[model samples]
Target: MPGQLQIAVLPSTNPRLGIVFALYPSTELSSPEVASMGMTLPSVPRTHELPPVPPDAPFIARERLLSLDVFRGLTVAGMLLVNNPGTWSHIFPPLEHAEWNGWTPTDLIFPFFLFIAGITTHLSLSSRRARGDSERAIRDQIIRRGALIFLFGFLVNGFPYFAWANVAGIPDPTFLQRVLDRLMHWRIMGVLQRIGIAYMVAALLTRKTTLRQQVVILASLLFGYWIVMTALPVPGEGTIGALLLDRAPRTMEAWVDRVVLDWTRFGMGNHIWVGGVTWDPEGILSTIPAIATAMLGNLAGRWIGQRRPLTERLSGLFAGGALAMMIGLMWNWVFPINKSLWTSSYVVFTAGLACISLATIMWIVDFQKVRGWTRPAVIYGVNPIVAFVGSGVMARCIYSIIKVPYDGKRVAIQSAIYQAGYASWLSPRLASLAFALSFVLLWYVILSLLHKRGIILKV
Candidate 1:
């Protein structure tokens, strides 16, 4: 393959010369001319040159902006912070999701991740198309990546599969009871699970769909969800939840959640979701509406990539985002902005926020040329999947699987740190947050090394 393709390059002294030697683009030298006693042969493009995009960023194409990577890196950072509390016993209200009917900063995390994923899908597919990749190849690639992500989520959620903590078939509880307790405690739906489903369906649906078609589909999903939720009677509560839900279409998505993705545990305030373990926040039914959030992101990415002025692109995102946010608020009177079920109003509202956030990033990084804080984020962004998976697995193994007996107690290394430094001296919340931040820094350092070495692990 290297021999067949023409590789583009430039002469530069880069630190990662070893990788460049192996993976550099292949370029054919022009027919060689005889050298004279005092003359040297013409210099061919150097094999060590990078793509034309700045060395500081990674995008679908080298010349494209790096806002998407920034978005993704920030998101991964947020996920690590939220997931890795020093102690579960002490958490700030902001770090926790709202009690089913309100919004919080933490609620924005999932939507932000999904929204970025959508934008990335658009940029990547478009770049591939520009390079004349066949539609079939793109489809297959999407399917494979989507499946792998979903499986990864499932594996993470099912870590240890059987509880090693329950070794020796302890008789304090029946063996069956032990396993059942684990299942009961297991959180079935989570961040990556949602990403998997959303990417698979959204990518297939949007892969070949026209912009007009996408708008139509998006509008129809929002409104159609509205109608079903308000009109249809919930199974257990009848129309109480539907009517009390206050939002027309938002209830539709929740109703779907209650009907299909039941199997939830007791939620906040001891209030059960009322469908007998059905209606998870990250359940199957609400995911339908989640796709629209990704669509909103795709639309922004498409607009940004157009050859329009940078100001025009940013303004368009702000304008569209404002409109969506207003519409969401207007609809919220009938359908509350609930994150657990991902109501249509919530979807619109969050997507608007996502759009505004992304536009601001583009305005500063790409437009104003401010790049002071971009290097760390850009490093995290280069190999997003690797960073996320590696960080998650490493954190889990250290915190849970590895145990050290200290002070006559069997404690994980993470717990030992908290016990000694946090519970003993500092406030739990601060300690927990510190641990989370430390986790992020650890991953960031690893990613920095990868970035410096030009090790982009794209799968």
Candidate 2:
């Protein structure tokens, strides 16, 4: 197949000669090969020495940005910390999600990951296109990956389907009935499911469009969502006022989720929020703006990929982030920055924060060449899919699947451990924090070993 190709020269004992040639296909060069070549492959683009190409070069060869991986590692670490507290009931304020409108530090993790997914989508797709991958091949990959991610999430949600020992005098049902119940009540939407949808949409939108067109599409999504959410009258509310009409069960977003997902089918109703409202925070309507979040990340990826000075790129990122924040805050006056709604304002605000955070990390880690403290984060970053899926399954096992005898009654193994190990002496909040920290450390150790062995589970 015809495509753009790059050959990298490796150092040899003889200064004048190259020992090996590293071939990078447009899609992705495996980490082991990159490590062997002694190059730190960041998600950002870097200059390369290549043979002269004709005017119609099908691909662009670029260096990876180290900062992107560091940023991803930091985000995943934050996810583990917030998600695995000793007791969800006793979590620190920062670790807990905001009730409805405002956002906490905890809220940032999911959006940040989605944003990163968008950035990587652009990088990976561009590489494949340059490798002469057919349009059909690329589309199939995007759809298949998205589907697998969603399916993984669904399986995780229904993990360890039923406990053999019954509780509360409830009669034991047949095994087939148990399976049926799990399938019927399983959550249709969740963190990974939303990510899958957002990533797929963002990839398709940016696949062919120019930067100018992407910007226009992004603006339209945000503005269009704001109008639909605020101007349209909610079913029960009977009238539309942005403030009065935009709360949990009364909002249009929730109504759509209920109608499409059906409250009766799931029996549990909407499970995304704290209240018993029949609405998911990551519902169908809100996913529209979430796509904008990824699109914004795609824009950042493109900017970073440009052949420009690092200083110039950093400046552009910071300046763009500040501008986005200002616009987001301005929009928030009318459409409050509600994470539940995934409001247009919230998308702009969170994306702005992501850009600024990434730029700072780039400045310190990439430009300043700080290497000592980055190893842990880099380890976590390279194997993010592993960390996320593994940690999630482990948490579910601790929280629900395993039960232990406690004070003459069966209790969740996690609770028993918390009560006996940490909560016995420490205060509630402190105990919770300690447990969360321990979870993060455990995952770090696992990820570190994987990194040392040059194993990365790419999804």
Candidate 3:
């Protein structure tokens, strides 16, 4: 019984219900503790290492991968942890985004999510094809789903749809005018927007292409982006893009963001990132390499879908990932591994790390058959959009939208909570970490309930 896998059937929105398996020490599948651990599959670490099956034994024709779910859950959990610290002013170095170039642990999270998106795209499309779905149906689904995701991101950007609570120069203005002002200044691109765009383009591009053809397309994207970024001149700046890289606002990407997204000439004001009015981290030109990152994951998914032994697949992933890391590092010397730019080197490097991380998780959960501790991640992974959108909206309300009287002055609810509950007794850094951990735990409770009810939100 020690090495035997335990199976649990859960309802799913997909026609194929999700079948999950875990290796437990006993056969008490219905125990309260076991029931608490829920995961959905549609669907991590250091050694750079890494299932087929019988019918009714977890791997049916539309079997789900527990490891993929676990990996995605972990990434989403990490996003929540990093994004919701008690105070951004006091945080650990690794948890923080690199100021400009290079990467910290935080930098890897977005690319990891995108890479996983690419893998699932491949797996999902394959499953649909196996079910006798026509290519036209598949294409329509891709476009519709991709558009919906982008719409969700767009909506989140302009959430609450309310006027600013405070404006420096404006006296009390009409509510309609204030609302219009907010609309005019709403941001146009962000993490989810970029993810939707990259996933849609990468999926469509690889939908009908052969393995060799996908590789060629990937190569063109990375190399072509590198050439454009390093060789092309910034129109009015009269300088190559590479030369302007250090000056964030002067880069070609920033120029494009300003030109297309900023509507000041038409009185709509800027729609780029509020942090950088002239630029956006998830800018247009940089997305070319982001697509490459997703395609790399598509290639890995193809490899996993092969009929080879598990060991063979593991070896392929490890070897290929290591080779990619080396190549990306070599490329980094020229382009720099920049998260903001989503540079060519950053794409390859992060995708390689994603491969290695997923391979490691597979080895643990699948090859070794040890997954008892994977439930929290599984919960977060299954309903990522809910976590992302819900958390984003909640943060806005608590951090800025709602306020309370504090020290005879108004302060955001989150700030009041931090000052009272966390900052009162703990060091600044400790308090920040505690608040973030608490936020993660709170979401875990919410997601676990949904997971228990077999409710998964899929776009």
Clashes of each: 13, 8, 3
List where candidate 2 sits over 4 angstroms from the true fold.
1-62, 163-170, 241-246, 263-277
Worst 10 residues of 1 by lDDT: 32-41
TM-score of each: 0.78, 0.85, 0.88
- Evaluate residue 80 in candidate 3 and report its C-alpha lDDT on the 0 to 100 scale: 98
Name the 10 consecutive residues with the lowest summed lDDT in model 3: 22-31
Task: Order candidates by lDDT, high to low.
Answer: 3, 2, 1
Per-residue C-alpha lDDT of model 1 across residues 320-403, encoded as one tens digit per residue: 989988988887888778887678999999999888888888788767877678767665554566766677778787788889
Instruction: Go through the candidates in order and give each one's C-alpha lDDT.
Output: 0.64, 0.72, 0.76
Better of 2 and 3 by TM-score: 3
lDDT of 2 by residue, 1-459 (tens): 122222233332321122111111112343322322222432223333233332322112234456776788799999999989999789889999888777899989988988777766666666555546788877766776677667767677667664344422348677766665555556777778888788878888888898899999999999999988999887777877374545687788887887877656656433343243478877889889998998898888787756688888899989998998888888888899888889998999989989999999889877888767876777667666678789999998888778899878999999999899999999999999999999999999997666545454434
Query: Judged by TM-score, which candidate is best?
Result: 3
lDDT score at residue 434, model 2, on the 0-100 scale: 96
